[model samples]
Target: MKEVILALITGFIVGLVFAGFKLPIPAPPAFAGVAGIIGIYLGFKVMAWAGPMFAEFFK
Candidate 1:
């Protein structure tokens, strides 16, 4: 929860700065960005779930 709040605050500030400078925000469009993040998180979780099983199998 703390990390989520901090990330929101930082993103808001960076957004404001980018808009003030009239530059593009350095990220994908909203839905794509969220989907990408979700994909990355899922990938990490999948690896974590499989890692122990693979290690035991290879032993």
Candidate 2:
């Protein structure tokens, strides 16, 4: 997707700049943290999709 590519490119640029300046990268420093963020996003998406379905079912 366009958004995904743009995000990756932007992150790469920021990372390079941070490295050049010897500053810490501003992001989760571990895979588990990244996974948790992804899990949260998925949870939100699932609720968004299911909320309407359940509402219609109960009506």
Candidate 3:
């Protein structure tokens, strides 16, 4: 359980940092870029955080 939570938190933070830093990446979608991965992960993390918080208050 602890490891899962830690993984979640680390993933979230790393994703945010990646997006915030806006590291350079090549154009075109054909590339398996690290930046792209970070962006997607950040999107998922944001959704995860918002979903639970919003649901709790609304219910």
Best by lDDT: 2
* lDDT of model number 2: 0.93
lDDT of 3 by residue, 1-59 (tens): 99989988987787677678995323334456667887899998997888886786766
As for candidate 1, its clashing pairs are none
Model 2 misplacement above 4 A: 53-59
Worst 10 residues of 3 by lDDT: 23-32
Q: Please, what is the whole-model Cα lDDT of each candidate in the order they appear?
A: 0.90, 0.93, 0.74
lDDT of 2 by residue, 1-59 (tens): 99999999999999999999999879999999899999999998998988887886767
**Model 1 agreement with the true structure over 1-59: per-residue lDDT tens digits:** 99999999999999999999999987776898889999999998997989887886767
Q: Return the lDDT, model 3, position 59.
A: 68
Model 3, position 10, has a per-residue lDDT of 86
> What TM-score quantifies how close candidate 3 is to the native fold?
0.38
Indicate whether candidate 1 or candidate 3 has the larger lDDT. 1
Q: Is candidate 1 or candidate 3 better by TM-score?
A: 1
